[model samples]
Target: MSGIYIHIPFCKQACHYCDFHFSTSTKKKSQLVEMLCEELELRKDEIGRNIQTIYFGGGTPSLLNSEELDHIFKTIFEYFKVSETAEITLEANPDDLTEEVIKMLNASPINRLSIGVQSFFGKDLKLMNRAHNSEEALRSLQLAKHYFDNISIDLIYGIPGQSNEQWKRNLQQALELDIPHISSYALTVEPKTALEKFIEKGKVKPVEDEQYREQFDILVETLTSKGFEHYEFSNYGKPGYHSQNNMAYWLGKPYLGIGPSAHSFDGRSRKWNISNNSLYINSIQAGKLPQQTEELSTTDSYNEYVMTRLRTKFGVNLEEIQEKFGEKYKLHFLKEADRFLQDGLMDTSEETFHITPNGKFLSDGIAADLFYIDK
Candidate 1:
């Protein structure tokens, strides 16, 4: 099934480690919203099918006002065939999720909430420059739980000063809140971000790979022991609470990504809109799609499929690979995966291959090693 992703690229302030495309100044938000609507109209025919999931990801989607949200929804419903039971999700920040906002969101079409609660500790929040304080984080989550049943929260571990005790406390806090789904990730210091600069200037300590690995194990053990499924590497969900939009994307289902810097994937190719807001607005206003398209070669598609599937419980199927990509790719995959399997980093049962316990933290690197660079 196909889905749609709407990116709202405005934030209250820049987080230290975030390198996502967003503007802190929201003066142009209203204009950008109009452009997004126009772009939706422009791209409706791309899907040509009923949308099963709709995701409002961001700089911060919770920042959208009721009127702004309504306008976008109206535009979507007008042009697109959305399923009656579509899973609609919004990514929100704790600082922005006051009771009134939560009530409004519950009243709207959004049925899922992914709150940005990077850490439950003030020290970690401050170090990451999160917009919310610790108290606000807890308060917002409790409030959201009252309004929504399908709730997810984003948490980051392995901050510069975060101890194992602190990380455990954060997970404990999430459990106490009774959140159904969680999207937890290790803090990566992206180039040109404030965190990288801080490390270079000696204002922040460099992130430790060992620390990340330790915390990752703790995350897996704690959540899975509590009956949460490690569905994807960075995601944990109780039964029936997994993110539909995420599943759609990972399963190679087509999706039309709306708004600036967003991406779209058809069965054959992928494309992305321009990252600059002004340029995107101008281009959409002029009735042009400000995006670049790349037609995927068979090798590109196969590599992507292998990369995404290996990290999940749904392992790569050798039979499907052979059937879809021919004997050459299946043979190449098996040959490359042999070393990892022998190293005890990968496991195969019947025709499917999955990440072993020792290989979970290194899934991405292992996937990279298996990627065939077409010469």
Candidate 2:
């Protein structure tokens, strides 16, 4: 099934670690939203299937008022063949999830909420420059659970000063709320971000490797014991609650990405829109698409399949690879995977090969090693 992803690239405030394309100013918010609706209409015929999921991601989708959201939804319904039970998700911040907002969202088409509750401690929140405090984080989830059953919360580990105890408290708090799904990640300092600058100037300690690994281990063990499926490397969900949009992506289904800086993937190629909001709006007004596209090579396709599938619980399907790509690719994969299997970094079922827990943290590197280099 196909999906649609709308990038709402406007945030209330910029977080210290965020490097995603977003504007802190709402000066062009109205125009951007209008352009987004236009983009959806422009690309309506791209995906020739019923859209099963609609994900509202980035900058902070929670910042959009009800009227803006309704207009966008109306446009989507008018232009796209959306499934009746589509999984419509909004990525929101805690501070924006006021009771009033939750009430409005409950009545809207959005069936899922991915709350960005980075940490539950004031010190961590301040360090990350999150807009919400520890109190707002809890209160938002408490109110959200009351309205939406399909909810996911984001948590971060490996903050420089976040101790094992603090990380445990964070997990315990999420579990106490009975959150069905969670997406957690290590706090990597990307270049040009405020966190990276802080580290370079010695204003903050860099993330320690040992602490990061320890907390990751704690995260895996703690969540798995509580019956959460470690489906993707950084995502865990209960049965019947896994993210449909993300799963469609991992499985390499086609999707249309609308709005500035959004990326789209058909079966054979990938494309991304221009990152500048003004440029995007201007181009749309000029009746032209502002995006770049790339056609995938066979080797490119093979490597991508390996990279995305290995991080998943289903792992790499050897038979499917052989059937779809060729025997040579599958043989090459088995040959290269020998060392990882021998070292217990990976394991193979009768039909699939997957990273073991010992290798999950290093999955990206491992996937790179197994990449299909055109020789």
Candidate 3:
């Protein structure tokens, strides 16, 4: 089964650390939605399989009123073969989730709500320049959980001044809420973000890797002790509550991404839509898809397999690697992995090649080293 993702690239405000493609000024909000609908119709035949999930992700899907959401869902139903019981998810901000909006969303085709409750501390919220306060964040979650059982919350850890105690408190608060799914991520200063510039200007302290390590350990231990499955590296879910749409990607299932800065994959080649909102709208208005496609070469495919699988809890399967990429590549990887395996960074069962707990911190570096370069 395939999935569909629609990026609503508009937000009420900008988060300091965020570098995602979005516009704070939503002057073209109406036109943007219309173009997304058009893009849906234009690429309907790209996926030949039945849609198992439809995710409303973006700058802020909760920014959309009921009417806008309805129009988009209606268009999706009309154009695509959506499963009768497809997992429809809408990513939302806590500030926008009023009781009225929650009630409206309950009646809509949307089945899940992934709220961005980054922190429950006002001071921490201000540090991140988040739009929601602690009170609103808690209220929004409570209101949505009343109607929707399948709820997920996003939490951020490792802000500049955030301490280990504060990080643990945040995790405890989330656990107390009994959220079915929790996505926790460490703060990284991505290049060109406001956070990065602030660090360069000495307005804010840079992220400390030591602090990140402390927070990450706290996160893993606390969540696992509470019986949450560390399903993906950054994602945790209660029994049987894992995100189906995201799981599809981790499992290498095909999906179609629509709207500005969105990416799509058909299990081989991948395509990305233009990040410029006006350009995206203009191109679709001109009866064209604003996207660039890349055909995945054998080496590209092999490297992707290593990267994605290594980050997962299931780890990399050597047999599948050998089967799909050939025995030569598999043996080469096995030989290359010898050093890491002996150094306790890699673990190998007869069936899988996984990273040990100590190896997770250096996962990216290890994956890069394991990458297949053109010879």
Candidate 4:
């Protein structure tokens, strides 16, 4: 089955560390919603399979009023063949999930709520320039659990001055809430973000590698002990609560991504829409897609496969690689993986290559070393 992702490129405010394509202004909110529906209709024939998942991700999907959300959902049901039990998710910010908003969302088709509760502490909130406070974060989850059973919350670790004890407390809070799914990530300093600027100006200390590694280890150990499956490098889920949309992405299933800065991938090619909201709306109004496409070369496909699969619990399937790509790619992969395997960074079982706990934090570097670079 396929999936659909709709990016709502608007937010109430900008977080210092965020570099995603989003606008702080809501002036184009209505126009953008309409254009999104139009884009969905325009690309209705792209996915040949029934839609099994629909994800509303972005700057903050919760910023949309109930009517706007309804309009998008109505358009989706009208244009696409959605499965009877499709998993629908919406990413929300804590401050936007008020009682009224929660009530409205309960009436909508969204079955899952992925709350952006990065941290449960006031110091961390202010440091990131988050729109919500610690109180709002706690209250939002308390209110949300009353209505939505399938919920996930984000947590950030390795803030410049955040200690391991603070990180443990964040984990404890999530466990106390009994959230079914948790997506935690390290605080990365992307280029051009305000965080990078602060670091450059020496106003904020940079994240230390040792601190980041320590927190990551704590996250894996704590969650796994609590029966949360470390299914992905940055995601933990309890039993059946794994993110279907994200799983579809990892499995390389085709999906249609609507809205500015969104991406779509078929088996052989990948496409991304322009990152500008106004340009996207204008182009859609003119009956043209404001996007670019690239055909994946054999080496490009192999490298991508290695990158995505290595970060997952399933690791890399050698048989699938040989059958899908060629014997040459498979042999090249085995030769590259030998060093990591000997270094206690990876292991093989039933002909599958998976990362060991000792190598989890360094998965990205390991995957890169195994990349199929062309001569």
Note each model's CA RMSD in angstroms.
0.8, 0.8, 1.1, 0.7
Better of 3 and 4 by lDDT: 4
Highest-scoring model, lDDT: 4
Candidate 2 lDDT by residue in tens digits, 315-352 = 99988898778988999999999999999999988879
> Model 2: runs farther than 4 Å from truth?
none
Query: Candidate 2 lDDT (Cα, whole model)?
Result: 0.94
Q: What TM-score does each of the candidates earn? A: 0.99, 0.99, 0.98, 0.99
Number of clashing pairs, model 3? Answer: 0
* Per-residue lDDT of model 4, residues 313-356, tens digit only: 98899999998899999999999999999999999998899999
Which candidate, 1 or 4, has the higher lDDT?
4
Pairs in steric clash, model 3: none
Clashes of each: 0, 0, 0, 0
For each candidate, what is the lDDT? Answer: 0.94, 0.94, 0.89, 0.95
**C-alpha RMSD between model 1 and the true structure:** 0.8
TM-score of candidate 4 to 2 decimals:
0.99
How much is the lDDT of residue 297 in candidate 3?
A: 88
* Model 4 stretches astray by more than 4 angstroms: none
Clashing pairs in 2: none
lDDT of 2 at 295: 99
How well is each residue in 276-365 modelled by candidate 3, as lDDT tens digits? 999999999999999999999878988988887888787888889888888877887888888999999999998698888888877778
